[model samples]
Target: MNIENKIDELISLINYHNEKYYNQDAPEISDAEYDNLMKELIKLEEENPNLKRVDSPSNRVGGKALDKFDQIVHKIPMLSLSNAYSGQDLKDFDKRVRDMAGSDVEYVVEFKIDGLSVGITYNDGEFEKGATRGNGVVGEDISQNLMTVKSIPLRIKEDNEIVVRGEVYISKENFQKINEQQENLGLALYANPRNLAAGSLRQLDPKLTAKRPLDIFVFNLEYGQNLKFESHSESLEFLSDLGFSVSPSYKVFKSIDDVIEHIEYWTENRGNLDFEIDGMVIKVNNLKQRETMGYTAKSPRWAIAYKFPAEKKKTKILDIIVEVGRTGTITPTAVLEPVRLAGTSVSRATLHNEDYIREKDIRINDTVLVQKAGDIIPQVIEVVKEERNGEEIGFNMPNNCPVCFEPTVRLEGEAAVKCINMSCPAQIRRGIIHFVSRDAMNIDGLGESIITLLLNEKIIEDVSDLYSIKKEDVINLERMGDKSANNLIKSIKKSKENDLWRLINGLGIKFVGVKGAKILAKNFKDIDEIMNASEEELVNLEEFGGTMANSVVEFFKEDKNINVIEKLKKASVNTKTIEDKNSNVPKIFEGMKIVLTGTLPTLKRNDAKEMIEARGAKATSSVSKSTTFVLAGEEAGSKLTKANELGIKVVDEATFIELSSLSSKEEVESKLLL
Candidate 1:
């Protein structure tokens, strides 16, 4: 074969094998064979630069950097597939497809791999670009990480322009292997494969991407040049021929029963597969037929994922215990006999509340069905009544604070048992921890470890004493140095000037959050006004529930808390609301929802929320159209995720600070009467 022909053959061979290696998880060829083919293509492209094409299998590693990256608008809006929870929902989807395309319509079904979705660009047979499926319009460029997937070809076999969409999944086996390695190396274990894939693919550098074991399966041929395929089935075949790992084993059905049968066939066998398959994606096979059907605001009209029922396993409840939260509410936890389910060893599950325990008749020594709730937290899904013994002991939520041994009480119509004592050691410590957290007052060098050190040393007993830390004592502490100590002192000093809402949140009062603090700050302007207000006064505030109103009133009524408030005043923590400020800064986001991301330049993120909310805006962690602004900074993660998804407006720190006009927003309210 000619050198050019060899390059073409290499691309075809790699994609063909990649489809097996990634999608099918079955490789007829050895890794050595795959490596040699890649080497041949790389050498050919290097020897003849003009012969190099963007879509060449060799280009999968990445492409040329741009002066400014332009967002590629998807030709067809990438829509999220609707989920079918039951067989009936699956039948409904089949019915809808039938109504649109008649009994003659063919459908394609693929494993809904629990992973990240991305779009890959191939120009003239070389992989040129890849990006996350961000809002289906603009995605973060992830060409580097996508290339690291051994299954994704650097180049394609066909000499044509193409943009194929696919899922990037970290196999459960690979995920466990990486986690075990991370644990051995003393790195934090990623929660699961999807989060790992997401974090890995979003990395800016390819060198880092090479570290993670990722795999890809091409499903949609987003764009095709010189490719003639009328139906999705035909397109998949052509793409497979060109060396892409298309989905396997989709059965064409004239009736819903066949589609239902296909889904039922996989549900039991899905577990037998090496990779995770949460659901089966059913879609119209014909491309033109899809266009005729159209779309909804979020999902496609033609496709739906029939999710497999959550896996449940019977496990014995060894005991029940209550864990005190930062707010001093004791939450019930079930200590279970260790059982392997849904990827990890399950030893404990949450009972949610006392009512949940009673409602389920859950008892110590009783075997129950435990499952990953929402595929995240482990919980007892149902009681295995057949196995229940009469000798089993019923479990009860604690009547006292687990940590402080103080009597607890649940309010009317509420399920949580709250530790009413403000100075309950658990309550105070947890509150102080929250106060110094990154989002709150954000005292640098004041993490849980440092707080433990401070508490053990008896250097600081309360949140007010946190402000009174001596630089010499802090520097002299073990595990801290002069430079770090100095920087920490500087950060702590900077934090003192933050708005009052940070103080309120850090206090860890029940029913008061960043948004709640803002409502109090804006309405009352000072803590004194809030303290003087009764439950009736609080209930009058917008969005303040009766329980929240009572909680606020009760929190302020305590003499010890009142004394702490006075101490906070003595330390000059910001207690004055900006509603009283004469600054001309217009609240661009009055009553609008806002999310904070990354580390801010000037204000702690929670402190920034305090600023935004002081102007009558509300702060939320998730972004939506209701979101007015996203304060973005270095390493912004989830809020950034939603901002990109919802197309929310984003701003830098200087702009946010400029918008707040709070150069002096930090000045303390006033020295309270002491």
Candidate 2:
């Protein structure tokens, strides 16, 4: 066969295997065989770029990086479903649906996948566009990113225009693997699979999105040109036949009671599944009935989501221990008997502080009810006092640092007991770890274990000491080879040029977080200016309070901290705030408080925030009456609603961009008036 024919054959073969392995979870060929086929296709495509098919399986690896996602207005709004928390709520929903429509209503039940919702459009059997379900009415186009998902078929068998909706998710196993990789790399681990999947899909680089293990399950046929389906179940079957992955557990039920029973069973056994599902959705099966029932303002009247409550498990607290953080704050943790909760084994939970423990009356050997807060951090919710025996021992906060034997002091009106000794080993180790963290100096190859080794070997005494280390100091250490040591030294040297905000955050000053550091950096030109600033001067800055100002003053007052700053300066570290080159841009948004919501059409949220802040606007997280305007995009949620309710001004990405380009505040006001 010719090269063209060979390429087509290879594409067909790889797509078939992808469907089998990813969609059906059944592989007919070995991974190596599949890989070899893909390699041959990639080689052929590289040799003959003009002959590469649009639906080539090679696209599953990634495409060109996107400058920004374009806005796609969905033909039909992707209405959210109202939630039902109890069996009675489900019954009420059924009664309401039957009362509105007919008594012969049947329901299709499927898992309410805890993932990002997206709409994919296909034209003449080939994938055209894919977009996030932003605000239901509009979404950001993510076609390139969606093409990277192996389960999402690039081409279908049928030859008609179709729009299908699905949930994109990362499997629990993949989530664990990704977190492990993050831990090894000394990066912040993702809080949950849902967030990771959402973030992955929204990545500016399709290659980065492709690196994540993403999967999708199509649930709805939103639009089909000249096609019809009798019921929701029928459409799902059609989707599955079209080589799309559909939920395997969906079932049609004639009785609402049966649906409730099924939901209950899944709620109890959701842990068995590899993917996360926060609830179950019950939709009116018949298409004609759904049309008649229609939708509410924000949700469908023909369907309701039965939300599963946060899973709580009973476990015994074996002991309580306190850990000193980088800032020297003491945090008490409960060592609990290992119990499975939210698909992970829980062996410990945060007791928060002394007040929390005293109020909860938690004790060692006491049976406690533990649950994952937002399916991430494990925390003790309630003490099972009825199950606790009299033999349980109450615990108290330590009076001294466990690691350094230094006296711990609790400040007035503060819950945290802190180790004030600046040289505490625990504090030093944690501080070094923070100094090399991603948001700080971002020195790669310096994970916790490596830092611990360096500290033990006496090669580094503090954060400043890291700058003076030689290649010989690390090359002979465990897990450190010549190349690794060289890379480490280069990374350490490169970090000296980071912006002033990073250095301030790395200092681990009390009450000065990332945002606070940015605020400080914006106000002060260098560390010396900040050190000389009075508490009143700090308090006068935006978002700074008396407590934060006092913390900054007290931190700089210490002779040890001044010595460290001198050392950092002596090593040629950049301490001055780097001024933006675009200084000509007018501060049209000066003194205006803006809240951003949803996905912007042509800008990342952070980029938009930084742009606004640079132009003299404060980007707040929530909408309030005091908000000057809300920059809303597709899928703007509660913030948009609240903005509307409070009569706060709202602007789109276009308007915000226009305002940003205005020469003066008067021009901005004139534009808004127009």
Query: Candidate 2, after superposition: displacement of residue 138 in Å?
Result: 4.9
Cα lDDT listed for each candidate: 0.75, 0.89
Using TM-score as the measure, the top candidate is: 2
Alpha-carbon RMSD to native, per candidate: 8.6, 4.2
Minimal lDDT window, size 10, model 1: 665-674
- Per the 3 Å backbone cut-off, how many clashing residue pairs does candidate 2 have? 2
Angstrom error at residue 273, model 1 = 2.5
Tens digits of lDDT, candidate 1, 359-428: 8988888889999987779999788889865869977777778777888999999888788776787777
**Candidate 2 positional error at 516, Å:** 4.6
- Per-residue lDDT tens digits of candidate 2, residues 1-674? 99999999998898789879866999999989988998999999999999987789889888789888887888888766677999999999999999988899889999988889999999989999999987667788899999999889888998889999999999999998998998899678777788899999999899999999999989999999999889999999999999899986899999999998999899889988999998999999999999999876667789888989999888899999999998889999999999977755689999999999999999999999999987789999999899866889989888889999989999999998999899899998999899899878889999999999999999988889989999989999987999999999999999999999999999988889889898899899999999999999999998899999999999999998999999999999999998865466678888889999987777878789988887888899988878988888766867876776687877778678878888888888787676
What TM-score does each of the candidates earn?
Answer: 0.76, 0.83
